[model samples]
Target: MTEPNLPSGNDTDTNSSAIPGTAAAWERATLERLAMATLIEQRQARRWRNGIRIAWLVFVAAVAWFGWERGAAPADVSKPHTAVIEIKGEIAAGGDASAEQVVSSMRSAFEDSGTQAVVLLINSPGGSPVQAGIINDEIHRLKAKYHKPVYAVVEEMCASAAYYIASGADKIFVDKASIVGSIGVLMDGFGFTGLMDKLGVERRLMTAGENKGFLDPFSPQTEKQRAYAQTMLDQIHQQFIGVVKAGRGNRLKETPETFSGLFWTGQQAVEMGLVDQLGNLDYVAREVVKAEELVDYTRRDNVAERLVKRFGASIGEGSVHALKLAPSLR
Candidate 1:
C-alpha cells in the first residue's frame, strides 16, 4: 500500500479539505443571520422612539389648543354687549370664584368701551369673607370710575359671603324660588381632646407664642380663648352687617331675625328688600342692560394655571403637615 499511492486514500484527504470549507460557509451564514437580526432589532427600537416623540407632540398641541379655547373671549369686542362675570362655587382664594379672578374680570369689563354694563352671575354657598370683601370693594370702585351699572343675578343660591358680594351690585335680581341671604360670620371646628382622652392618647403640641395654638382642636381651649374667639366673630359679624346696611341703604327692612344667619327664598328676600326684583340673567341682559349680546370677561384658570395652583397647594399642605400645624382659616 505504501509502494503505490491509493486513489481511495487521496479521496479521503480531499474529503477532509472540504470539511473546513463547509464549516467556514456555515459560520458565515450564521454571522449573516445574526447581523440581520441585530439590524431588525435596531429598526424596531427606532420606530418606537419615533412613535413616542410623535405622541408627545400631539399631546402638547392638544393642551395648547384646549388652553386657548378656555381663555379666549367668545364674542366680538367691537359691539355693545353686557359683560358677564361669573361668581360660582366657593369663593376661596384659589378657587375659580375667587376675589382676584372676579376683581380682574370686573376691571376688564368696566374698561371695555363697548361694554354697556357688568353683570355678576352669582351662585354659591359662600366662603372666605376676605375674598368677598375684596370683590365687593372692587365692584364699588369700578362702578364709580366707569359709571357703568353692575347688577347681580342670583341663580340657585347666594348665602353668607356670596350675599356680601351680591350686595355690592347696583341691584340684585333673583328667581322667586332661589335661596338667598346668610349674613353671618363663624369659625367652626371640632374638639378632638375628649376623643383622645378616651383613647388614652396625649397631645404633643409646642408653640412659640402663648396663643399660637389657641384654636388647636387636640388641646383643651380655655374660657378666655373661647370668649376671645366669640368676640372676634362678633366683630366680623358687625362688619358684615355694616356692609349689608350700607349696600342696601334704606331699602333693607331692618329686623332682628334678618341678620340671624337665616336663609330665605328669593320672593321672601324681595319682600324683605334683600333683592330688587324677580329676574334671570337673560332678563337682565335684554331688559336691564339693553344688550342681548352677552360677553364673558370672567377670569378663569386654564390648564397650566390650575396645575400650578394644585401643585403649590399640595406643597403648602405638605409643609403645614410637617410642621404639625392645624389647618389655617382664611
Candidate 2:
C-alpha cells in the first residue's frame, strides 16, 4: 500500500483559493507529525530508563554474589569442621572491635547450619570492662545453646579484658611466645596538685556531693576516696578470678602467683594452667576442629561506610599532625 501524503500549507489551488480538502489534509498531517514527535520522545526516555535499570540490576547481582560467596563458602572441609572468627583490636563499646562484633561473629559462626565448631582468634591486650563482660557472657550462652566446642586461640597478646573473653571458651590455645593473662583492672590518670600549687592555679571544681569528685586527677586524693576506689577494683578483681577459675576448671592452680596481674609467655601460661594447649590458630583448626578451610561471616564495609571512614580518618590524622607541628613555647 502507498503511504499517505497530505497537501502542504503552501499548496493552494490557482482556480479556487478555498480548498477544504487540502486544508483538512494539512491539519491532519500537522497533528500526526506532532503526535509522532511526542511518541518518539516517550520511547527514547523509556529505553534510556530501561538501560539504566538493567545496568544497576547487574551491578547489584554481581556484588551480592561476591558477598554471598564469601559468607557461604564451606566453613571447614574436615570431618569435625569449624568456623573461625577473629577478634583483633580494642574491646571498647561502639568501636569496630566491640563486644557487639564479637557476639555477632560468634552468633554467625555457631548459628550457621554448616558450622560444627567455633573458634575465636583473639589478639588484643584488652579494653573496657563492661564490653569484655558482655562478650564473655555472650560466648557462654552461645556455647551452651549450640552444644558446639568454642575455642580461643591467642595470637600475640590476650590480656585483661581479652583474658576475660578467653575465659568463656571451652578450651584456650596460645602460641609459644604469645602474651597471656593480666587478670586485673586498672584506671590511670594524672595528679597535678603540686604543679597547680606552684603555678598559682585553682581546680575550681564544685560538686553536689563530696565523693562525686573522688577521681579528679588535678586534686589530691583523700584517704576515704582512695579506699573507695581500691574497694571497687577489688570487687572487679575478684570477679575476674571467678571467671578464670570457671573456664580453667580443676586444671587451674590456685595461688597468689596465678592472679598476680602479670603477663607471661604462652609456654609459662600452659604450665600455670591458664591455657590448655600451646599452638597457633592453624594447629587448633586442623588438630582440634580438623577443619582445613576458613569462612568469615563478619560483614564487610559497605561503599558509603568505607568512604566515610576513609575521609574521616584522613581528616583526623591531618588535624593531629597539625597540632603536633604547632610551636610549643616553655
Instruction: Name the top lDDT candidate.
Output: 1
TM-score of each: 0.77, 0.70
- Candidate 2: lDDT over CA atoms? 0.81
lDDT of 2 by residue, 117-176 (tens): 788888998988889889889988987898898889999999999999898898899989
Query: lDDT at 212 for candidate 1?
Result: 85
Number of the top-ranking candidate, with TM-score as the measure: 1
lDDT of 1 by residue, 56-140 (tens): 6865775676664455355568689999999999999978999888988888888888899999999999999999999999988
The segments of candidate 1 whose C-alpha lies over 4 angstroms from its true place after superposition are: 1-75, 308-330
Off by over 4 Å in 2: 1-80, 299-303, 306-330
